[model samples]
Target: MYPADLVKPMREELSVVGFKELHTSTEVDQAIKQKGTTLVVVNSVCGCAAANARPGARMSLDNEKTPDHLVTVFAGVDKDATDTARNHMVPFPPSSPSMALFKDGELVHMLERHHIEGRPADMIAQNLKQAYEQYC
Candidate 1:
């Protein structure tokens, strides 16, 4: 597990913008099962996450249509929570620095690690905005 001090700022990068950090499996389950659309981010300390995924997710929220709930699970830190969140994202395999959209408890959209890595934040934001337009 990453040191809490080391990950704190990374965690706050989203939490300060309204993303709830899920540290337990129960928290993950409860967040996902909530009504309306939820955006779940499998956060990581990778460069891609720092350069793109997080910025994109924050940017995506500027849209007129946004997920009702925003939550995140840290891959190397919140192991149980991340595992449970990955379970909810079945068939996609677990990947940090990934994003998923769920509407009414059903998975509707996903951005795997490959989708986030090497992409500009704007592109990722636009991709998520499109998903929000369709599924949010």
Candidate 2:
């Protein structure tokens, strides 16, 4: 895991935008079980994450139909939490810097690394906005 100091700003990238950070498996489980739309970001230290995913997620929240819950689990720093979060994404392979949208505890939409990589932040935001329109 990256040192807390190095990853602090990365964590802040989302927390600053109001995303609650899940640092434990129990926290991941409880957050996803909430009775409303929830956006779970699988945050990471990858270049795409810093340059695209975090920015995109922040921008996507500006949409009219934002999720009721916004949270994140850092992939490398919070391994247990990240693994538990991925468990909620069964059938979908794990991917760092990914996104999962759960509606009343059920997985609804997912944006994997392949989807985030090579995509501009605005485009990623647009994709998320579309998902928000359909599911949030």
Give one digit per residue, the lDDT tens place, for model 2 in 14-123: 99889999999999999999998999999999999989999999999988899999999998899999999999998899999999999999999999999999899999
Kindly list the per-residue Cα lDDT of model 1 for residues 1-80, writing each as its tens digit: 99999999999999999999999999989999999999999999999999999999999999999999999999999999
* Model 1, TM vs. native: 0.99
Error of 2 at 34 (Å): 0.3
Residue 86, model 2: Cα distance from true site in angstroms? 0.5
lDDT (Cα atoms) of all candidates against the true structure: 0.96, 0.95
User: How does model 1 fare in lDDT?
Assistant: 0.96
Estimate candidate 2's alpha-carbon lDDT, on a 0 to 1 scale. 0.95
Top candidate when judged by lDDT against the true structure: 1
